[model samples]
Target: MPNTIVELRDVAIYQRESLVLSEINLDINKGEFVYLIGKTGSGKSSFMKTLYGDLPLTQGSGTVTDFDLRALKEKDIPFLRRKLGIVFQDFNLLPDRTINDNLLFVLKATGWKDKEEMDAKIEEVLGRVGMKTKGFKFPHQLSGGEQQRVAIARALLNDPELILADEPTGNLDPQTSVEVMKVLQEINRNGRTILMATHDYALLLKFPSKTLKCDGSKVFEVVQKNV
Candidate 1:
């Protein structure tokens, strides 16, 4: 077992030749839940993008889930992402698809062939997230929290080692936000490392963890607690 599942040593990221994150050094271990908090345009999303291989590395070395991000091939991008689960503030469910279909789509894309196995996997994850009943429901029918839970189930479909969430509760109500956080916490308890970017300070204080703040083209810990 590796102590560090995500290692970013002296890594730099750029968009359109403009630097976004410079010299970011991070060593995130397995089974850790890290709260990634930062202001907008402070490279929170950009950093997440880098972790998921959406942005090309302009400088330095990076490795996510044992794959060299700086040296990642186009064909390997999909494989790299298979080890990562991402959640966003906005629920990105397919409007035309049911919850079960959405999960099935991901399974098929990731090489899950047997319908029985796929059905069992889908049922298992949805049950774990407390949305097994809502699996037949459409995205629009569920509440914001329910939809986000489905999104979480989708992210877990590939059995990802890490989760990179960007403001996952920004659009939900207070009670619902806390509920979603509980579900995320439950997932983290099951040995998945989660790095979530959020603007919700109340939730941060309520469920404090290793906090990283991105500002002034730098990313660092907020306190010794983060260490």
Candidate 2:
């Protein structure tokens, strides 16, 4: 139980009073990589949002990085986020800023005050994502996969306990998606817990891990066929 990073029991997630997923039970341990798969409107996004404090959890109980989801307040969201990294379907980079600036902005907003330390962390994360040399480039100058790599780099800047990726490869071509996936896989290999929401079944086949599927308001694990 001590190594569990995310745990939910009898949990129900809702969006503006509409119950999305109910009676969910999941336990993710430290250094694990889990996949979330489902069709459109099947509550995968809602479930991910609930984990990162974007959506409120009104019933049952859940916890992420030791923060209780039911009792989480707005003021506590930032603190909660500091322990988690979130990646969106769209590469949410600032268009006008270079990749370095985009990463720097997050560091500063998250309370990084030292110039030297901020720069060091920015480089370190970019290096992890294999984008160290591209930091001076603007987001528009890079390909979709490159942009997503930058996004992943940004996510790793805080040394988060968990990385919640919501359809991260949704906008990329197949090859590009794999490239971005490698970055995430490498991060996971280095001990960062990952929960990725994806519709690309090919990825599931290629880089299979423990998968959970959202179907008809319930979440359950996908049974892997014996090879």
Q: How close is every model to the real structure, measured as TM-score?
A: 0.97, 0.98
Candidate 2 segments whose C-alpha is farther than 4 A from its true place: none
Over 108-155, each residue of candidate 1 has an lDDT whose tens digit, in order, gives 999999999999999999998899998888899999999999999889
Backbone clash tally for model 2? Answer: 0
Pick the TM-score winner.
2
Query: What are the lDDT scores of the predictions, listed in order?
Result: 0.89, 0.93
Weakest 10 consecutive residues, lDDT, candidate 1?
A: 218-227
lDDT string for model 2 (1-227, tens) is 77999999999988997899999998999999999998999999999989999998899999999999999999999999999999988989999999999999999999999999999999999999989899899999999899999999888888999999999999999999998889999999999999999999888888989999999899998875521
